[model samples]
Target: MEIVIPEGSGPIAVHGFARPRPERAEELERLLLSFVAPTRAEPGAWQYQVHRDAADPTTLVFYELWRSRDDLRAHLAQPDLARFQRDRMHYLREDLEIHWLTPLTAEAP
Candidate 1:
């Protein structure tokens, strides 16, 4: 599918954190990384990054940007996401909370 971004509009940013059951961390990490390739291949993906915490090994965080909310919706509707949601409960200790971010300013430090 082709994604068209309207002029003067910003990309939609999705940021979230996930913590898995301690013993299931590796299993969950493997599951989470499985989405990267397919998600990055999508037409709407501007960036996709999964971050694993240093001090907290079981906690994983995700930062993703898509062309628009519609693009994000498309991502959510993918088959892998459906399966992931179903399997996540076996590994995750808590629900992941993802928030939409509106970028105001970005600068290099």
Candidate 2:
């Protein structure tokens, strides 16, 4: 899945990458995939998507957009996200690389 954040100051863009332990790849994938539905249901969530690297199957990446920083915080505080946080690292190799972005410009058709 993929999400393209709109160009604006009000919305927050979140992007990240994760590498799962080879032995736990399947479990980790399942865990991450589970976030799709609940996350999209969030009122403040503009977009959310999880991706798997074609070359490195253990690699995972995701992009999300929220109405504001507070909305992003609310997402992190949600029970579903909490569970994912607790379990994800157990199956992951390296720490997630997450960035909070402020979109200054964009071009969309």
Candidate 3:
């Protein structure tokens, strides 16, 4: 999975891959849910969602919306976010794939 944050709207994507272990799947789900509230409360956040692929249980994706590119960059640098990254890293087979995007129009409704 890949997250695509549009350039003008904000970060386009965040993709997470979980360990093959069944338990790791559940752990990633819990961790993602835990971030929802905090991420939604952010000043520049417009949309934030945690997504799991229906076809592939081991893949996770985060769709985020921010006020601007700077806001997205700031979010990435936040200290609180560090812990989540650290914890999730152990479960990922490879580094997360994040994409910053510039949309042609508004994102899909």
Candidate 4:
């Protein structure tokens, strides 16, 4: 099933990649998983998912959809997220790579 992004909500989509230090892969996965539930519970979150790259287990990717830019900003300001950003270096091999996306297709049928 597809997520229904509310009409006129100006939804914002984010795509990100995080590669953990080889020795910290499992720990990084656990930390990333911890955000799933709480992030999906946030007010404007349409979707929040995490995945491990099939060919490269140490690489993690995130897909998020928020109702608006404001909502996305709010999520970034959340305490847990702030803490994660502060301590990411301990778990990641490099800085997180983030991309803001624009929908090219019409709403899901």
Candidate 5:
């Protein structure tokens, strides 16, 4: 699932929440971080970051960049991705919300 986006386009932002389970928070963070290194190494990945809400620890945010939407879709399809999703879903309190983002300006290089 390689997403094809125009060059210099803005990043895609996916934000969502997981269950408010303190016990699984650390494990979730560990699992999420485990994918960080590999995701950054991906060809289309420009940036990939996970953020925890200051007010609510259970709330997680994902900020990702890709050459194109196809790239992001491909990343989601990775083999180990299922495990990641499963882990999060296991403790998630609510459904995930995903959003796609595009740059507002196309500045010249």
Candidate 6:
């Protein structure tokens, strides 16, 4: 799908899902939670949050917004993210499913 950004310098929004191995739900949650503080502290990170489904604890979700796409790219290159990518197979049932969002509503002025 083609994602169009109305403004060239607009914040980038992202939504993603990660399914943990059934037995590793808590472990995965801890690992994911560890990224929150550091990620939120990053230069261009406007928001970085994680959530787990109450009905399906193994399903993890992330909602993030960055100053720009470049910031998001830099975030993906962080050491912790690289390590997570390398080691995710041990804890995840499948790879992360990420969806980049295109804003359709104007920011409140």
Number of the top candidate by TM-score? 4
The per-model lDDT (C-alpha) reads: 0.76, 0.76, 0.63, 0.81, 0.65, 0.79
Candidate 5 least-lDDT 10 residues = 1-10
- What's each prediction's TM-score? 0.81, 0.80, 0.70, 0.84, 0.72, 0.81
Report lDDT (Cα) of residue 83, candidate 6: 82
Supply every candidate's count of residue pairs whose N, Cα or C atoms clash at under 3 angstroms: 0, 0, 11, 0, 6, 0
Q: Residues 40-87, candidate 1, lDDT per residue (tens digit)?
A: 998788778899878876789999887766777789779988777667
Candidate 4 stretches with Cα past 4 Å from truth are: 1-9, 105-109
Runs in model 2 with CA error above 4 Å? 1-9, 105-109
Worst 10 residues of 1 by lDDT: 1-10
lDDT of 2: 0.76
**Cα lDDT tens digits for candidate 5, 44-74:** 7877788887897677777776666667778
lDDT string, candidate 6, 1-109, tens digits: 1223334567778888889888888889999999999999888888888988788767999998887877777887899987887788788888778787755652422
Question: Could you report the Cα RMSD, in angstroms, for every candidate shown?
Answer: 6.1, 5.7, 4.4, 6.5, 4.8, 4.2
Candidate 4 total steric clashes? 0
Worst 10 residues of 2 by lDDT: 1-10
- lDDT string for model 4 (7-108, tens) is 344777888899999999998899899999999988888889999889986799999877787777789789988888788889988888887776554242
Model 2 C-alpha lDDT per residue in residues 1-109, reported as the tens digit of each score: 2223344457788888889888988888787888889988888888889998789766898998777777777888899776777666688787777776884552221
